[model samples]
Target: MNVLVLYATVEGQTRKIAEHVAARIEGQGHMVVLGDVRDPGFAVPGTFEAIVLCAPIHMGRYPEAFVRFVTDWKTAIEAVPNALVSISLAIHSDNAEERAEAEAYPIHLQHKSGYHPASVHHAAGALKFLEYDFFKRFLMRRIAGKEGGPVDTSRDYEFTDWAALDQFIDAFAGQIAQP
Candidate 1:
């Protein structure tokens, strides 16, 4: 199977997650192509048997580039077995409402883009305090403090679950292998 893994990232965590997904899928013996949505030279739709799109949530929304890509390619994307990996710090929040809000991001994207992925995975994102500017760092620290996340802005905090992500890739591979 040929799988294309494309992503839109804010603080680069989504790109890392997309890279891991590509590696895992390749390890499963499928040919994988990884690309960024912001690039003009990404793989087009009809070439891949399966596709996985990943994006990070910032300020309660996905990046505009990602939304535009999905909107423009909705038909080709829906023609194949596709999945969405939505990365958000809210997924790591202890608050139920925050987590629910994180989950709803994808639904909102679906409504806006007219593309509904067959599978959706909500993965916890990272807090890249070291990479943020002063204003963003201050704001993120406040948000993290409220959500009971690590507030120490000296370094980064990653909340992604590798095992769960591997399981999702395995299941997706199996799905493509059938019929």
Candidate 2:
């Protein structure tokens, strides 16, 4: 099978997750093409049998570029076996409402873009304090403290569960391999 793993990232964690997804899908004996949605040359070549679209939620929404991409390619995207990896730090929150909000982001994106994915995976994002500017770092630390996440701004914290991600990939691969 051929798969396209595309992503839109801010602060870089979503890119990292997309790379990992591409590598894992390729490792499962499928051909994979990975690209950033913001790349000037990025295009869906119509050769992929499956796709995994990943994007992170910042503030309250996905990047405008990501929303635009999905809206533009809605028909082609929905024609294939596609999945969504919705990355958000709120997925790791101790509060149930936060987690629910994180899960609902993909739904909102679907409603906005008219691209409903076959499956949705909610992945916890990271807090890259080391990569943030002073203001962002301060704001993130405050939010982390309020959410019961690690508030140590001296380093970054990753909440992605690789094992769970692998399971999702494996299942998707299996679905694609079916007749």
Per-model TM against the reference = 0.97, 0.96
Off-target runs (Cα >4 Å) in candidate 2 are 40-45
107-149 per-residue lDDT for model 1 (tens digits): 9998999989899998998999999999999999998888777
Kindly list the per-residue Cα lDDT of model 2 for residues 1-179, writing each as its tens digit.
87899999989999999999999999888888898888826547367789899999999899999999899987888888899999998988889999999989988998899888899998988999999999999999999988777888999989999899899988988889742
Model 1 residue 115 lDDT? 88
- lDDT of each model, Cα atoms only? 0.90, 0.89
lDDT, residue 116, candidate 1: 92
Which portions of model 1 show Cα errors greater than 4 Å?
Answer: 40-42
- Top TM-score hit: 1
Which is the leading candidate under lDDT? 1
Q: Cα deviation of 4 in candidate 2 (Å)?
A: 0.4
